[model samples]
Target: MWQFLKTWYHRLASPKWFYHTSGRWLPYLAAVTILLLVSGAIWGLGFAPEDARQGNSYRIIYIHVPVSVLALVGYYLMAVAGAIALIWKIKLADMVMVSAAPLGAVLTFLALLTGSIWGKPTWGTYWEWDARITSMLVLLFLYLGVLALSRAFTSRDTAYKACAILSLVGTVNIPIIYKSVDWWYTLHQPATIKLTGGSTIHPAMFKPLLVMIIGFYCFYALVLILNTRAEILRREQRSAWVRELI
Candidate 1:
């Protein structure tokens, strides 16, 4: 099992292998992403029961929660890729780290946008310095910081090292973001979906939420693969294989 894992790790670390394999995955991934997103949207927004308290406005959770969850998850992915690149000296890992930064930033912005839209109805205001929201704002900056650092240097190695360091250092904020609501007195609601004690949401609502979460994950994966493949092509443009393919 260890040998199997090691062999696959080496295979995946190869940019050419990932580029070819992920190309095969793209069509099926795009199809599944579209199907899941459309079905989940119709189920959550159109068919699910309205919130007794927040009413129809709460339906935004179908979009908000999934993006919010994935924004945090994306940061983890970026940081891990950075770590791998720094330690293993894998060019593919650097490509993945770079690809994830902008995507995570976009998702974080969407989470904040939808949260604000949801807030006006529930919190009587669109913007607040609530712990969760503020931490998420900080997260956006962290992602932006990584993006900025990644491009600041003319040398790719320098940029990768700088971005890797920033990503690793910035990870301290992730835990703060996760525990903010629990640790503070804030208007932001506690997580509705819990892994340990079971979700607090009604089954009808939970089902669609679950579907949306999975759909968002698929979407994230699809985009990451597409972005990484593009990065591989750009970086490998001078290689014999890339030259031949082009």
Candidate 2:
């Protein structure tokens, strides 16, 4: 099993191997992503019981929570990819890192946007400089910084190195973001979904939320694979395999 796993890891590090393999999996992945997102949206928005306090306005949690969770997760993935590229000098890792930056930025933006929308009703304000909100805003800027650095250099290697260093440095903020509400007085609510202690949300609402989270995971993976494939092609355009595949 270890041998098989090691072999697959090496295979996954290969650009041509990933491009062809991911292409075959795209259709099935897209199908599952669409199914989960649509069903989860319908269930959460239309069928789930209303929040006693916020009423139907709470329905936005279906989108807000999932994207928020994945935005954090995506940054972790990006930083890990950057680390791998920097340490192992893996070209495919650089591709994955580059592909993840914009997607993470967009997801972070959506999380902030949805949080603002949710806040107006709950907090009586559209925005606040509270700890959680402020930290999340910093997260968005970190993503933007990585994106900008990735494009700032003329040499691809230099750009990748710069982005990788920035990504690694930015990871320090993630834990702060997670713990912001706990560490300070904040309007942003403490996490209701706990991995170790189980969730505080009612089962009726939590069920669709769980589905939406899973759906967002799939969506993130689908988009990442698609973006990485494009990046692989762009970087490998002069290679014989890419030319023939094209």
Candidate 2 backbone collisions, by pair: none
Worst 10 residues of 2 by lDDT: 181-190
**Cα shift from native, residue 71, model 1 (Å):** 0.2
Using TM-score as the measure, the top candidate is 1
* Per-residue lDDT of model 1, residues 1-246, tens digit only: 999999999999999999989888899999999999999999998999999999999999999999999999999999999999999999999999999999999999999999999999898999999999999999999999999998899999899999999999989999999889899967999888887897789999989988999999999999999999899999999999888886
Clash count per candidate: 0, 0
TM-score of 1: 0.98
Model 2, 1-246: lDDT tens per residue?
Answer: 999999999999999999999999999999999999999999998999999999998999999999999999999999999999999999999999999999999999999999999999898999999998888899999999999998899999899999999999999999998888889966988898988888789999999999999999999999999999989888899999988974
Which candidate wins on lDDT? 1
lDDT (C-alpha) at residue 181 in model 2: 82
User: Which stretches of model 1 miss by more than 4 angstroms?
Assistant: 1-4
TM-score of each: 0.98, 0.97
- Candidate 2 wrongly placed segments (more than 4 Å): 1-6
